[model samples]
Target: MSNYIVEMLNIRKEFPGIVANNNVNLQLKKGEIHALLGENGAGKSTLMNVLFGLYQPEKGEIRVKGEVVKISDPNIANRLGIGMVHQHFMLVDTFTVAQNIILGSEPKKKGVFVDLKQAEKEIVELSERYGLRVDPKAKIRDISVGMQQRAEILKTLYRGAEVIILDEPTAVLTPQEIKELIGIMKSLINEGISIILITHKLKEIMEVCDRCTVIRKGEGIGTVNVSETNVDELASLMVGRDIVFTTEKTPAKPKDTILSIKNLEVKDSRQAVMVKGLNLNIQAGEIVGVAGIDGNGQSELIEAITGLRKVESGEILLHNKSITHLSTRKVTEAGVAHIPQDRHKFGLVLEYPIGENMVLQTYYQKPFSNFKVLSFKNIYQYASRLIEDYDVRTPSTRTKARALSGGNQQKAIIAREVDRSPDLLIAAQPTRGLDVGAIENIHKRLIKERDKGRAILLVSFELDEIINVSDRIAVMFDGQIVAEVKPEETNEQELGLLMAGSSKEKAGEL
Candidate 1:
């Protein structure tokens, strides 16, 4: 009998113009937390989708507990005790937690309707058992992102998932939530459940995974024991290069203030106060990083600056000129560039071609368009230049923006925003879901922009990025700028404390 619980041999999946997975093999041992490590488009998700029955592989053999099986759909995979939690959740917003969790596998009371009471009771028990606390009666739309993720995990476990697949589970979570998730994974593994975590975060893999299988450009590179390998080795295996974790750049030469937010008050779409009396200043030739836990007014502050959200009061100035309540186009015209936090939401048009998306902000200007008539020739030429320069891997500039991988999409946004050479650049979560190579490239571009006298406001939850990329760091807590400190004067520990509302002297004492 084989010790492996699940085995996918020589899997081959192809899409139009791209071979997603080519002869990729994955073996999962019983009762082990394994990591599927790779770049964004390196076929990690494709291989998992093949296993979860979302896509059929043209060539592969799947074995479950030493028995060969054919899985053609999600129902079949569920019957075979395989469950997957995708990066983007699949939940009905109108449904309650219990409703979403027990949708297909609901307990019938009278063989006619769902047993709501029984389902809620069972959900409570299951959540307690797994330490995934979620209100059973809470609506999905009203709950936080972390709670929704927990509900996703519960959906899999409720269906008897002996072998679970988690795809980038910690990407959107706060640092606190990530620690809780790590604890939950440990508890699940202790209870004899196996997990295959699909991620590129070397820190999480090293801390949680028992072993790791690396894939690069649709082919399996190798697998190594987590305890025996280091982060640098894992990074090299994943990206096929010696990864420089820290970006090298000269000190900032800050001059006049490029952007100033004085007593800014902003509200969300729901009319809730998010950014309250916030004051921030960014000078030319410097990067000012806003470091905070997620939901601490970062999104609202960025939106307020970019003219996406309404300012309830106060002012935003670009180059000493008031830009508060200006139209987005007006703000863009005033030499402001924004790489929004949610790429799909505000950055790109999914239905448009990659070339058209490249000139979204500047298309109405010269060269791209004249008298409201777009010039496809110039658009494609410009996109081609950016694609080559920024290393945006795509079939062609004619490809739809939706067809590109997350990292590639992010790269395209960076190319479009950075090429404009604006005076003040707002980069929000610039390297959110990219691999080491792509991250290094993006970081270099940001620093280069700063060196060229562009004032940059970087908002990121990644502490390392905030520390390494920014010359000055502002710690935000509860919709306010709590403290300002230089990178050289603080560590992650001190910054974390300040972000949580602890003063410098208190943090030092702690």
Candidate 2:
């Protein structure tokens, strides 16, 4: 008879030397969507892990329907009608959608054999009822990320879960797919299902959630009705600071091309032509943003430009100097600072301390060292200065990179790469996982670099970021640059059409 469906009161969780959650409290009203807002490492995921029975809280109690309950494991939580969809998917790549969904709870017909027909029929009905359409027969590896996410959702729903938790649900979805996800959430709400949305995107929180709980540094700040608070207010509550959201920059002054790509083609690890005839250029003192859905050759384009991928038939010129077929280090030496898309692989060494990560590019040379042995003092000083200037929020330079949050890690990488003073600064999804304040700072820094005669090539999936930070926008579709437009002259609709691979005649006139 209670209005509240579930509540976690004064939760405390710890690991090694860190207290992940410090007295965090959360309450969920039945059939209402609630959002958990925080920075990357502010313990949003840690708190949710407690609810899903992934971690046992050192203190505090979990109550369901006003009755205290002990959830010892995920199996127990599942049996209690609680389900969680993790940000990083947990699906078997080799299995079909139906197999993955009905792995443990498969319908039986011949005692030991799974009833494929019955399972497919029920799955199709469930997907249609909830607006989570999925190709149940398709292999998990062959389906799109959006489809995989829907499949995961179906798996939870199939288990008769009345309470669902979605972590960064729209992180990898396209604009259209995001719309579909919102629709599905609405359907679930109508069906008397309670939902929890965990995300960093304030806009998505504003659009979908009923109420939001702000958390910072493992403590619950407060919860507010979504209608009563704006992004500025929500951001300040989460970060404990009055932060600006937009980048303040004058119009770009056009100049000669600084970085040029001519008919470039790049093959990915799977031997696919990821970038097909990707022709683009970044001019001095201007920012050119590549906007597209994921897996449409943005990664390959950046890799080819930064000398990570082999160019099959094209040219990459840095200030009129051909740099195609060059090594990554050689490309860096040729006046290019590339912040790779995958920060973990190409940005920083997780095992290395902050001091060592700061000098990843130029540690062997420069003021830090003479030739062989690294001067620990110089390294520490350099790293400390960057951490202070960038507001990286690290206690010491001796802290391992892995210990830092995703946003802090990104900031450290940017501090090292952007500070090197390269003529061409290639930033790919630079603020993908950063909070609002960090995003504002990055935008300002990138604009400063552009104004100082450096060319910036930004690739991002977030439309707001692409529009706000870019002077010129290029739309990629099916491994090619389809259309280019001035940001001020374009709207999201036109760009959306171009992203869907509309014809030049249709897009130009429409």
Candidate 3:
């Protein structure tokens, strides 16, 4: 009998114009957390998709517990005890947790109607057993992202998944939630379940993975025991070069105020005040970072400034001109560019081609359009240039935005927003799902823009990014700026305390 629980040998998957996976090999041992590491568009997800039966390999053999099997679809994979949790969660917003989990497989009372009560009961027990504390009755939209992810895990567990594939599980989680997830992974392994973790973040692999396999440009590099390899080695193998963890930048040269927010008050869709009496100013040639836990009014502030949300009572000035109530296009026309936090929702139209998405904001202006008629030739030529400049790996500029990897999608958005060279750039969670190399490039671009005498407002959950990229750090808590400190003078510990509503003196004393 084979020692491996699952083995994919010589897997190759091809798209129209590119080979997504080329003779990649992976072996998952019993009850071990095996990590799949690669850069964006490097075929990590494609290989896992093939395992989950979402796609068929052009050439390969898959062995499950020493038995060769053909997994033709997700149902077949599930029957083989393999389940996958995708990066972008698949759940109906209106459905309750229990309903969503037991959608296709439900307990029928008397073989007529679904016995929801019985399903919830089973789900509760399963959640408890796996330490995934989710409310079975809560609507998916009403729950936090972390809770939703836990429910996704519970779905796999309830379906009797002996092997679970988590693709970038921690990408959307908070630090505390990430720690909890790590604990959950350990518990799952203790119960004799195996895991395949696909991620770009090196820290998580070092913390939890037993072993890691590196893939570069759709080709298998090698696999190594996590204990024997450091982050530097893995990163070099994945990207074919030594990755720089830190961003290098010179001192900022402040100029006149570019954007100023005074007594800004904004309300959310539910009519709740999210940004309360917020006051901030950004000068040309500097980047000011807002550091806060998620849901502390960062989104509201960005929306209000970019004209995506209505400002209840406040003044937003761009070059001393009021832009508080302008339309989104007007705001953009006023030399303000926004790289939104939710890329799919606000940044790009998934159905549109990459070239079209690049010119979304400037489609009406020439040379992209002449007399309101779009020039496809000019649009694609412009997109090709940006693609080359930003190093965005895509099949072609004609590819759909949804078809690209998450990191590559983000790069496209950044390319479009930054290439405009606006006076004030608002970057919200700009490097959220990017790899180390991509993050380095993004930081350099932000700094390069700042050096061009543009004011930048950077809002992010990453303390390392906030400290490394920002000229000044603004600690936000409870919908307001609690304190402002120079990046060089503060550390993550102090920032954490401030983000938790601790006073500077209290943090210092502690």
Give the runs in model 1 whose Cα sits over 4 Å from its true position. none
Best by lDDT: 3
lDDT of 2 by residue, 245-284 (tens): 7678999996889998999988998899988887888899
Winner on TM-score between 2 and 3 is: 3
RMSD of 3: 0.8
lDDT of 3 by residue, 127-170 (tens): 88888889999999999989999889988888889999999998
Worst 10 residues of 2 by lDDT: 168-177
lDDT of 3 at 279: 96
Model 2 pairs in collision: none
Off by over 4 Å in 2: 15-19, 102-122, 254-256, 268-274, 344-359, 363-381, 393-404, 502-510
Judging by lDDT, tell me the better candidate of 1 and 2.
1
TM-score of 1: 0.97
Clash counts for all predictions: 0, 0, 0
TM-score of 2: 0.89
lDDT of each: 0.92, 0.88, 0.94
11, model 2: CA deviation in Å?
A: 2.2
